[model samples]
Target chain A: MAANQEEVKLLGVVGSPFVCRVRIALKFKGIEYEFLEENLANKSDLLLKYNPVHKKVPVFVHNEKPIAESLVIVEYIDETWNNNPILPSDPYQKALARFWSKFIDDKVVGAAWKSAFTVDEKERGKNVQEALEGLQFLEDEIKEKKFFGGEEIGLVDIAGVFIAFWIPIVQEIAGLQLFSSEKFPNLYKWSQELINHSVVKEVLPPREPLFAFFKGRYESLIASQ
Target chain B: MAANQEEVKLLGVVGSPFVCRVRIALKFKGIEYEFLEENLANKSDLLLKYNPVHKKVPVFVHNEKPIAESLVIVEYIDETWNNNPILPSDPYQKALARFWSKFIDDKVVGAAWKSAFTVDEKERGKNVQEALEGLQFLEDEIKEKKFFGGEEIGLVDIAGVFIAFWIPIVQEIAGLQLFSSEKFPNLYKWSQELINHSVVKEVLPPREPLFAFFKGRYESLIASQ
Candidate 1:
C-alpha cells in the first residue's frame, strides 16, 4: 500500500485513559489520522468488527487493518513512524519500558482504580491502602527522572497518563483521597509535568466536565449500597 | 559487557505455566542460562528482590538485571538473540501477535482458569462455558495455521503454552472437562504439537506429578467451601 494512500483511523472514547495513550502517541509521532468517537453505551459496528475480542477502544486501523489494546497500538505507531521513538533503542531498555507500562496499566491503574470505586467503605479503605502502596512503588521508580522513559516523554509516560489526569478526577468524584502530593510527591510532580506537556495537553479532556460525568457514576455506586 | 561473560539466569518453579514460557523462549534461542527453582511457600530473597512488585516467577535476569513478566522477558530474549526470531519482523504483524498474546495471557488464561478453579459447582459450570467460548475464539483464529505465528512457534505460541500443558492438568484435578478435541480441535492439535516440540518437551513437568500437585491445591480450595 502506498504511504499517502494508506488511511489511518483511530476509534476511541473521549476521557478514557486508554484512548488518550494512542492519541498522544499519534500526535507525538506527527501522524495524520481520522478520529472516530465511539459511543460505548451502544458501540459502533466498526468498533465491534475491528476488535471482536475486547471490542474496546482505542482501536487503531492502518490501511484498514485493525489493532486493539492501547499499548499494542502505541507500539505499532512507534514502529511504523520510526521518528520520535517512544520505546528505547536498546532491547533491554525497551523491555524495561514495556514492563513498567504493563505495571501501570494492570496493577496501578486496573487494580487501584477498581478498588477506589468499590462501594463498601471498609473494603474500599483496604483496597485504597493497597493502591497507595502501588503508587508508592511507582513513585520510587520515577524518582528524579524527567519522565518514566527518561528525558523524553515515552511509552511509560503515555501509559501513565491516567495518573496525570483521570485519577484526580476519580478521587474527587468518589470522595476518596488516595493519591495525594503529601504522600506521593514524586508521582504528583510527574503528573503535573505529564498533563502540562504540549502533546498531552492537547488530548486531555477538560476537568470540570469529566468530574461531573464521574460524579454521577460515583453517586450511583454509593446509592446502591 | 562481554557476551560470553554476561550471566543469564531464570528464577522459576517447575510446574508454573509462566516459568515455562521463559524457559521455552530461552531454549528456542539456544541461550544457556542457570535455572533457580523457587519455593512459593517461602519465596527466596532473590525472587523477592528481582520481582518486588509481583514477587511471582519467572524472573529473567541478564547480567544481574531482573526483568519480570513472561511476555516481556520473551520479547527481550527475542530481541537480544536474533537467530530464531519469534515475533514477526513486520510492525503490523508484530502488533497482531502482541494483541493475541495479551488476549491469551489476560482473558483466556487469567479469567478462564480462575473460573475453572471456582469452588461452587454452578459457578464453575458457568465459568467453564465462558472459557469454552474463549477457546472457540482461539480455535477460529488459529484456523488451519500450524501455529499461532504461522509455521514458526512464535510469541503467541509461547504465551498460549498454558492452554497446551497446564489447563489439561487443571481440568483433571478440578474434575472439570472444559477443553476437548471434540470442542476445540485446533487448540487441541496445537497443544499436542506444543508439548511434543523438543524445546518445550524438555521443560514440561511430568504429567502425573503435575496432576498430583494440582489435585492437592484443588482439594484444599474445595475443602475451604
Candidate 2:
C-alpha cells in the first residue's frame, strides 16, 4: 500500500482518457492520492480553482499546488516521487520518447476524438484519415523498438495507451474502426501487451461503463451536429 | 570549449525553431555535440536514415541512436548529463511545468502559427482569438511564478520559447501583431525576458532571414489556396 498522502489529491471525471493517464501514473509510482470525481456539466469549485483556465479534470494537487494536463501530471508523478521513472536517463532516448508521446497526444487521440465528434461525413472522414495517418506514423516509428521507449513502459508508452484504450470505445461509438490488426500490426500487438500490465489493468475503469459513457456522449454530439 | 564526444551529434536544419531547441538544450547542459544541418526540401540521406518516417530534422544522435522531437530532446539532455537538471526533483512541480509546456506547445504556439499563415479572414480571426486565449491562459497560470518552472529557466520555459521567438517571426511575416504589450502584457514581458538570455538569443537564428523564409512560404501557401 502506498503512503496516505493527504497533501496529494487528484481531481478528475470518470471515463476521461486524460484522467486515466494520471491514475495509471500515480499507481505506477505507488503514490497514494485522494481522487475527487468531477462533473463536466457542473465542475467542482476545487476543479475550477485548480484549473481555472481549462476547468478540466485530472488536476493533481500536491502540497496545495495544482497541476493540470495528463501527460504533465504523469511526468510530475514520476519526478516528484523518485519511484519508477517514466522517462529514460539518456537525453537522446528521452527526446525520442517525447516525440512519440507528442505525436500520439496530438494526432492519434486528439484527432480521433475530433473525428468522432464531427457530424459532417466528409469532414469526419478527413479527420479519420488524418487519425489513420497518425496511427500509421506510430506504426512506422515503433518499428525499431518493442515499446516506444524500447522494451519498457515510459512516457511514450503511457501517452500512446490513450489511443489503444480509447480507440476501441471511440470505434464502438463512431461505428468505424480506426486501428486494425492488419493496418497496424505492431501497434495492435504492443497495445495488447501494454494494457495487460497489472498496473494498467488495475487503474483503468471497467471498459463496459467507459464504452457506454463515451458512446452516449458521441451520440449526443453527433445528434447536435 | 566543450570536449569532443563522438557519442553526441545533432542532425537538424538551420533556422528551425525545433532544431534550435535541441541546440539550446545541448549548450545549456554544457554537452558537446556536432551539428549537421539538413535541407528540409531535399532531406539528406542521414536525416532520412535517422528519422526515416517523418524525415524531419532536429534528430539528436547519441552513441549512434537517433532521437527526434525538440521537447523530447530537451528531456534527453537533462537526463543524459546530470549537470543543471532542467526539471525539478519534485513530482508535482514537474507536472505543473509539463502541463504548461504541453499547453503552450499544442495550443499557444500552434494557434499563433495558424493565425499567422491563414489567408481566410474568418479562420485567421478564429486562430488569432485562440492564440489570444492561449496567451491569456499562460499569463494567468504564470502569475504566481517567476518562470513557468518558477525562478529559473526550466523545461517548461524551454518548451514555451516557441511562442517567445517564433511568434515574433510569425507576426512579422503575417503582418499581424497578435502579441502586443497592451494585449498580452505578461506574455509580452515574458517574451522580452526570455529572448534576452544569451543561450536563447545565440541559438535562435536572426529574425530577418527567418521572416523572409516564412513570408515566402506563407505567400506561396496562400497563393495555392
Candidate 3:
C-alpha cells in the first residue's frame, strides 16, 4: 500500500450483510481501510453527518467523500481499484449483472426478509412461500454459472451476501427452513461456494453469536404478538 | 441508424414516468427503436417473458437480451453509445450521479408520491409534511448545480423525470400543491428547465390527458374511502 493512497474508511454495523458486501469488495481488491463500527441503536455523529439521507450503514468514505447505498459503494470500490474487476466490461453483460444485483436487493433481501419476520403465523407461511418462489427465480438464474458473474464472485454475488450468510441465521431464528438441497440445488451450492471463499470467510460474523442475537429478537416478537 | 443495428424495443405503459425515463434516454442517445405499449391492465407475453420477475414496465431489449429497471437500462444505453454520455466518466463523479439518482427514485418519488396520494385527510397532511422534508433535502442537493449532473442533464436528471413532468399532474389530481416556488425554489426552476428541454419535450405526454386520467383514479380512490 502506498503512503499517498487515498484514505478509505467504512462506517458499518456488525451482522449487517450490506456492510459485509463492502468488506468483501475491499478485500478482493486488497485495499487497506479503517473500519468504524457504528452502534445503530445510538448512531454516531460521524455516521449521521456522512449519510444524513439514509442514515444507515455501511457508508464508504474515501478521502473524506462519503458515498451511501451498499451496491453503489461496491461499484465505487471496483472503479477505484482496477485489478480484479467485479462488474462486466461489456455494456449488455454489465446491465445483466446490475439487473440481478438489484433483484437480489429489492426482491430477495427486502421482500423475503420482511415476509420471514411476519408476526402472523398464517401470513408468515404464505410470505415464506412467496419468498421461496423469489429465491427459485435466482436458483434458475445461476444454474450453469459458477457464480452469478460466471467465473468470479462479482456484483451479483456480492449483492447476495445476505442469502449466503445471514439467511440461515434468519431461518434458524424464525424456526423455518427456506433453503433445501433438492428444491434449490444451484442456490444452495452457490451459497456454500460464496461463504467458503477466502475473502467472504474473513468478513462473516460468527454464527453462534448471530444466532443468539436474532433468536432473542424473534422470541420477543412472538411474545409481543 | 445502421440497418444492421440490433432491433431495439421498449415494453412500457402510457402515463408511466418510469417508462418515460427509458424513452428520454433512448431519444437523448438518438437510438431508434420500436415502442410496444403494454396494456398494464392485461400485460403482454413479451413483457412477462422478458421481465417475469417484476412483471413491470420499461423493459429495454437490445437484440434479444432484455434489461429491466430504468436506471440500469439508462446506464446500458450510455455505455453502448459512445456519444452524449449520460453518466459521468470519472468514477467518483459517476458514483455521485448514481447516488443522487437512487435518492430521487427511492426517497423523493417513492415517499413523496405515496404521501400525495394518501386517502385519509389527517394522514395525508402528515405524509405530505414528511414528503416535503424529503424534497427539501433534494432541493439542498441541487442548490448550486443547474442539474444534478452540474452542467448537463445526466443520469440523476433522467432518474428524476417524475418530479420534472409527472408531479405537477399528481398535484392536480390529488389537489395538493406541494412544489411551491418559495419552499423549493431551486427544484421548481430545475423542473421547468427539464420539462422544456428538447429531448424531454419530445416524450412528455400532453398535460390535459394526463390530468384527466389521474383525476378519474383520484375520484375512485376518494369515493372508496
RMSD of each: 1.8, 3.1, 1.9
Report how far residue B19 has shifted in candidate 2, in Å: 1.9
Question: Could you give candidate 1's per-residue lDDT for residues A57-84 as a string of tens digits?
Answer: 9999998999999999999999988888
lDDT ranking of the models: 1, 3, 2
Give the lowest summed-lDDT range of ten residues in model 1 chain A.
A1-10
- Weakest 10 consecutive residues of candidate 2 chain B by summed lDDT: B1-10
Instruction: Report how far residue A60 has shifted in candidate 1, in Å.
Output: 0.5
Residue B168 in candidate 1, Cα distance off native in Å: 0.9
Model 2 stretches astray by more than 4 angstroms: A83-85, A88-93, A137-154, A221-225, B141-152, B221-225
Q: In model 1, how well does chain A match by TM-score? A: 0.95
Question: DockQ of each model against the real complex?
Answer: 0.90, 0.64, 0.87
TM-score (C-alpha) between model 2 and the true structure: 0.88
Q: Is candidate 2 or candidate 3 better by lDDT?
A: 3
TM-score of each model's B chain? 0.95, 0.92, 0.95
Candidate 3 steric clashes = 0
Candidate 3 structure quality by residue, lDDT tens digits, B52-160 = 8899999999998999999999999998886788999998899989998888887678666776677877887876877688789889989967888777789999988
Candidate 3 wrong stretches, greater than 4 Å: A1-4, B1-4, B121-126
Descending-DockQ candidate ranking: 1, 3, 2
Model 1 TM? 0.96
Better of 1 and 2 by lDDT: 1
lDDT of 2: 0.79
